[model samples]
Target: MTASTLMIQGTSSGAGKTTLVTALCRILSDEGYKVAPFKSQNMSSYSYVGEKFEISRAQAIQAIAARTEITPMINPILLKPLGNYNSHVFVKGISYGKMHAQDYYKKFALYKGLTESKNSLDHLLQTNDIVILEGAGSPAEINLQQYDIANMKMAEYCKAPVILVTDIDKGGSFASIVGTLTLLEKRHQKFIKGFVINKFRGDVTILYPSYSVLKKKTGKPVFGTIPLIDFDIPDEDSLHSNPKQISWSTKYLNVLDKEINHLSKIVEKNLDMKKIRGLLH
Candidate 1:
């Protein structure tokens, strides 16, 4: 059976896209659905060397969350920045050599890689009950819109419902969400199923007015508000530069259990998963 798909695109990097994807993967796995995670292209310094090739460590962690083996197909193209804005690109777990930013963007590299990414996604859809796609960054970057394989283009290709996630902690969450929606093509806007306010702290009730206004303005429901969870999870780049964050403490373990459980409950209580499921219907 062909799998149902969902794509999560954030307003910015570190908007909690990876964490939410990981949580959703675990939740779906717990519910007995065969779930897999996919990100067409990732630019990260931190990577996982799989059986044959290396992929982003974030995707590797996501696979674990889904109870699956690490595979480079999940992250088809990895761009490891090598300073001076140059990147050593890896395609399908094989090194494709290094190139400067202008050279990489100006050539056929992105398009060529899209073919492999699409093939990998097709393989994933055929093998799983559901595929959760995580886009690299905001879809609103008009400069990169045409060449985008990670955001709305990929969502359209998969016919997946999109969840626009914005980090409220970063402030201007409203403007970010609204501006992003405004910038998307009319057709792309229609693909959005809901908005997710992530990395939030303080009293959510205080923001109820803004939330209502956002829903009214965008004509999309607020999916949920995920609080600022200070649990240790490996982010793609942070995993390498800040190895200290990876350590686990029994003291922190109790906190992690409490926070994760609360986060799951928040997802269950605040987000309309039934509505999300209905998007595929």
Candidate 2:
């Protein structure tokens, strides 16, 4: 039987999609469910080689959260951008050589990347009790929607229930969330299970009134509001990282175990886990 899927999509890049997915993987694992983390395509300079295949370091980190071994299936397509519109693409952890952006989208992604991703996801669905999917960037990128295997298209392929997350640290969180939904076709919109407001600092009660207003507008509930974290978490993408922050020990994999557990506890306390689990089919 296929496992249940819960997809984490962001209002935009750096919106905490990876953080939520990582936390949930640990949470589910602690609950004694066999879980796996998956991202169809990841564009990152951070890479990890596990089981003799290279994949995005983010998925590898989430696999640790899940207490599972890393595999290429967890992140099948990795694109390390080279200069001048070209990216070094890796398919199933094997180098596919460098290709221009246009060719990657028009030829590789449209013709082959989606199929490869589906196959990997199918394997995980069959093997795990549940799979946590993390999406890249916003699903509402209209110009790239046609070749988007990382967001709505992937969610549709797996019939995964989506939880849209946004960073409250960024102003206009509500607008970004609502606008994202507004831009998507209704068919894609239906897959979203709810929204999560991340990196919040003030009293959560102060946000309650807004949640109701959001529900009134989008017909979706605010599933959670996560507080801004104090510690440094080596997240999937570095776009949002503080450039001046000191970095050191995360290089050693064991160092993240404590942080992962800490993250899980915080998310479990703040998030409506029962409702989130209910989203699984």
Question: lDDT of each structure?
Answer: 0.81, 0.89
Model 2 global lDDT (CA atoms, 0 to 1): 0.89
Candidate 1 lDDT over residue span 27-113, tens digit each: 777778888999998998778786789988778767766777678779988999899989999988899999887777768446777
Off by over 4 Å in 2: 238-251
Best-fitting candidate, measured by lDDT? 2
Global local distance difference test of model 1: 0.81
lDDT (C-alpha) at residue 166 in model 2: 97
TM-score of 1: 0.90
Task: Score residue 147 of candidate 1 by CA lDDT.
Answer: 77
TM-score of 2: 0.95
TM values, all candidates: 0.90, 0.95
